[model samples]
Target: MSLGSAFQTLCGALFEDSMTLVCSAVVPESLTKKYRNRMISPRDPYSIYQLDSINSSYLLVFHFEDMPDCRTIQLTDMHNLNCTSHTGEEKNLYFGYSHRMCYNYTLDLTTELKHHCGARGYEENMQSGYYYTNHDPNPDIRSDVSGGSLLGSPTLVICLIVSLLLIALLHWKTSRL
Candidate 1:
């Protein structure tokens, strides 16, 4: 089935409150193999991942909480879900996958819309699929770098002061001699 159909299935299965959704689809075996190691297993269903299998079928698991709006849900960023406004039509909802070097996942209000509550204008690209990261993805690490210079560090300032004091002592001894 297509990604659009899978999303439809997800909309139907969603309910009130927090829930874990497992949407299955018949994708190419190659696609499933590509993400096999990252696939979510039944043992750990909380995270999002594609199921590894011998056949051309795999399951996509997602964890989200229902929003106050009808049929609207806030998907966790940990799964690499990027929601955007449907091109041309602002009322529609578009979902896609994004992969970057770091596993930084944070909810951007600009990317998420309250109108996406209903899947009425929902659309997804066929290329979109689950993304897996072997390492820990921390968003704070990247944000912490403010483009400051090493000279701004306290350790460097202390070292500079000590060096200046040593130079003054050496000069005093030479003058006395």
Candidate 2:
């Protein structure tokens, strides 16, 4: 699958800029069913999560496929959803473009991008190796993608209850001593 044309042009404009802006993407398909159920809505393809320190905020889109590199996140599109106006110009909250990546992750101005994308221009400088594939960009996509809270799980509650009971038992035993 591929992204629409409008989304691609917008991505190019944002990435071409050297300015650093903070943003994030919400990929609901990244979470497991159990964890997803704990979320407000599970498997929501359109959900967006972000924090903004700049006047611009871009939403990087991706499409998932089942292949050898099944988890590879193909850059699909970008949406200029920034609400803040700039330079005495009206904020463009309705612009988009299509883009793609052979890599597993979408690079952006966030801690996650810093961790995966190298100092080299994000789209260029692919390292040559005898045993490397585009999937190397993100070998474990599902590991940390979940937004659900662990404390909301039933197992954690059971563990908490058991711990409280054990503490109460210990208190009683100490009083008897």
- Candidate 1 lDDT over 37-73, as tens digits, reads 4443323321222112211111233222111111212
Candidate 1 TM-score, true structure as reference: 0.23
List the candidate 2 regions with Cα displacement exceeding 4 Å: 1-65, 68-148
Could you give the C-alpha RMSD of every candidate to the true structure, in order shown?
15.2, 17.4
- lDDT string, candidate 2, 1-177, tens digits: 354343344344433332222222333333423333232233322211121222233232232111112111122224332232223232223222223322223333222332232222323212110100122233233334454766678988999999999999999999999
Per model, state how many residue pairs clash. 1, 8
- The models' CA-based lDDT, in order, is 0.30, 0.31
Q: Output the worst ten-in-a-row residue range by lDDT, candidate 1.
A: 63-72
